[model samples]
Target chain A: MFWRETYIVFRRQLRMALRNPAWVIIGLVQPILYLVLFGPLLEPIAGQLGAQNAYTLFVPGLLVQLGLFGALFAGFGLIAEWRAGVIEAERVTPASRTALLLGRILRDVLQLFVQGIVLIGLAFLFGLTGSILGMVFGLILTVLLGAACAAASNALALTTKSEDVMAPVLNSIALPVLLLSGILLPMTIGPQWLQVVSDFMPTKYIVNAIRELFTGDFFTITTMWGVIWTIVLFAAGLYVGTRTFRKENA
Target chain B: MIHARGLARTFAGRGRGKEKEEVKAVAGVDIDVEKGEIVGFLGPNGAGKTTTLRMLTTLLKPTAGTATVAGFDVATQSQEVRRSIGYVSQSGSTSPEARAGEEIMDHGMLYGISQKQAEARGRELFEQLDLDGLWTREPRAMSGGQRRRLDIAMGLVHDPTLVFLDEPTTGLDPQARANLWTHISDLRVRLGSTVFLTTHYLDEADALCDRILVIDHGSIVASDTPDALKRQISGDLVELVVTDAAQAGAAAELLARIADTGVDTDTTSVSARVRGAGHEIPGLIRALDAASIELESIEVRRPTLDDVFLTLTGRSLREDA
Candidate 1:
């Protein structure tokens, strides 16, 4: 019954997403621009970072960046859904409340996957090189990070319940994530204190894991921490988002 | 179809310090709705109409009450209650970007109906709700009235035995509201679905409801048929426009004799509520003529649900809403 309801809700969310897909591509634009305008600048410093080229290093970071920013602001849409009475409408039904949140999280993860593929496709044109398996692993990490962020974002949206509150809160969280996670530059190049602080950030571990995976390095401590953090974040997000949806359902 | 006793909900205190006091939104109200009865849950804003509706629909749990909607306990068997009833909230639930027909289909499926069955029922509802050629139309693109009709279609798509509508026509224009009323009335005639609707519109209660339940301050004030409730008020409202403003006081004295309510003299007008105004107006005109007082016009209006509310609550429903 739970899976059946999730599939029904998933189909509904997908249909709505497909109706005006311009937003999906629009969401990808920011990551693409960063890849195009900012990536070549990293090539000169690529040797210092111990990569074959800047594309390998920068592309993984951009994928992580996309995963974080792309999914982090999803609360805005959730707030719109809340105000539009979609949640209340669903609550009145016999549909599973957990299915509702899981279904939307699945939709968000699918969107993140597509955007990651698009970002990787453009990076290949910019002289990127990596083992196929490693790149796939890297993309998986990006998507996992996205699933976690999307779920957390939705939970935040349900809690705040208004765009005005959601906007500033997301903004405050977004700045630290974008700057501290080293999505643009490796934290190894930053101060020791900065690196220590970034260590506490979830995206920092996922970024480090994806960067290493792209270089065909998988069985390392960094990658292990990355997988663990990603799972923890996803679990935490699912827990909170489901709680919020269930509370609201009651 | 719906039975509730001492159905009450109390929200915990939100205010801080000395101001913190739990608010009883619905204070032990008993409600019994028969099958196929189009019952109007009439109340002004903040009168616990929506709160009671939510409790009955299982969206809200009552602090001190029991409600069995469609023969299922609201608290323990909520899923069963939800399956047996359709709820249309005041905001009109539909994703703005989703196609109208698909939205209905999805809602039906959520009720555990088959996709094929949902499609058949959805198309029929679209036709019934006057939403032809809007199968693929997005709700955001539809007009206000059309959106509301789509909401109704979604609710009925599951074909539940009971329907709960919370202020269904709150934001609709008169024509659209009246059009929706016909569709609502048709529900019981065609499908035998009992409707329990909440509304602040007195005319809607009179025109659409078989019975009206007036709620005030979290309690049921009165419950009866519209005509019966109106009869509780003393008489029809009568207003006399005297040609000479100076004769208003004299007219008031004469009008007071026939009035069951107090007569008011306002410049050239003397108005009061007169029982059986049809016979009394003729006598009133003759008395005015014998007194050599010229009259411009006399208006008589039958007692309405508003007057019923006024007599029951000591406050006009219109001003409160």
Candidate 2:
């Protein structure tokens, strides 16, 4: 029954997203623009600096950026629903609280998966090719990371109860994670303290995991650690988000 | 079908730095609704009618009290209570994106109806509520009355034993309100669903409800059948419609001299509460004639629920904002 309700909510969210075609176009356009402009600008510098597969390096960073953006927008959807009175309507229904939270997080995961696939296709066009198995691993990692960030965003949204608060809160967290998670630069080149701080950021793990997969260096223990971090972040996000959501509803 | 005693709810004030003050939305109150009966809960704004309904429906917890809905305790057996009762809030429940038929079916499915059975029940209710032709249309495309009827249809699609309607007809026009009353009466007769409804319209209670509970300031002040309530204030209502303000005042003074009775005067009319209206009419007319006040029209009628409400509460049922 819970799965059924979750699926129903998922379908509803997809339909609503599809209805606003401009948002989809806008969301898709941003990362594609970054991929087109930044990919070539950094290619020569990366190779001259002895970075392995400059295009491949850029792919993971773009994917992490897109994941964070997708997760932040997903949180905005919750605030919009509250303002529209849809959340209150759903609360009075018999839908399980757990299912509602799961459905929202899964929708974010799916959105991030779409964004990741589009970026990967762009990477292929730019002469960045990887094993099919490697691409599949990259996609899975992107979804897990997206789900974690989305869950955290939802937790913040529920606690604050205002979209004005949500927008700034997401930007403050997301921008720093994007800048410091070795998305645009390798941790080896960054300051030592910055590298240590990146160790605690979930996006850093995602970027590392995706980077290793694309370079065919997938057997490293860092990859396993990245997956473990993804799992831990996902679980923590779900726990905190669901608890706050239930409290807000109550 | 429903019983509540000592029910109370308090909401803590907002923000971190502010003192934690609790506003009692619902004070200690007791109510009972029997099977297959329509009970109208009458109250003005801020009278705690909606708050009490929310608690009984399990949407809000009572800070103090014990209550059972459909034989299930509201506190501990909330799920069971929720399953057995349907709640139609003051805010309409129809989603703008959902078509009427689909919305009803979704609610039925959530209540555990099988796919086949839910579709069948949805169709039955749609036709019964005269919404068969509009089933394919979304709520945004429908009229207010159509949407309100669809809301009622969705609530009944689950076949709950009891239903709570909070100001169900507040936004509806007269014709739509009448149509909703017809549907409500049919539900009682066909499905035997006990209805616990709240409304500000006294005539609605008189025409539809088997009993009425008048609440004020978080307390129930009066409870009885509409007729019994009106009889409690048994007296004659004498309405003297005059031509101008001067004549109205003169008529009021004449009626005052005739008897020590309750009197109310408006811009162009004077009304008096008198015992034995037939006998008092001649004396009243003679007094008015002596005062040189010309009466354009006079009406003598039995007390109505409005008068009963006024007598019990010292306030009009329809409050002016």
Chain B TM-score of every predicted model: 0.87, 0.82
Q: Best-fitting candidate, measured by DockQ?
A: 1
Least accurate stretch of 10 residues (summed lDDT) in model 1 chain B? B12-21
Q: What total of clashing residue pairs does each candidate reach?
A: 0, 0
DockQ of each: 0.72, 0.26
Per-residue accuracy of model 1 over B150-224 as CA lDDT, tens digit each: 988888988899999989898889899999999999999999999999998778898899999999889999999
Question: Which docking class does model 2 fall in?
Answer: acceptable
**Which regions in candidate 2 have their CA more than 4 angstroms from the true location?**
A15-22, A48-50, A79-93, A152-165, A182-200, A245-249, B228-248, B251-321
Per-residue CA lDDT of candidate 2, range A140-234, in tens? 87787778778888778767768888878777887888887888777768778988987878778778887888777778887887788778877
DockQ of 2: 0.26
Chain A TM-score for each candidate, in the given order? 0.96, 0.93
List, in the given order, the native-contact fraction of each candidate: 0.76, 0.08
lDDT of 2 at B19: 83
Candidate 2 lDDT tens digits, B118-204:
789888988988888887788889988888778777777778899888888888899999988998888889898899999987778
How many backbone overlaps does candidate 2 show?
A: 0
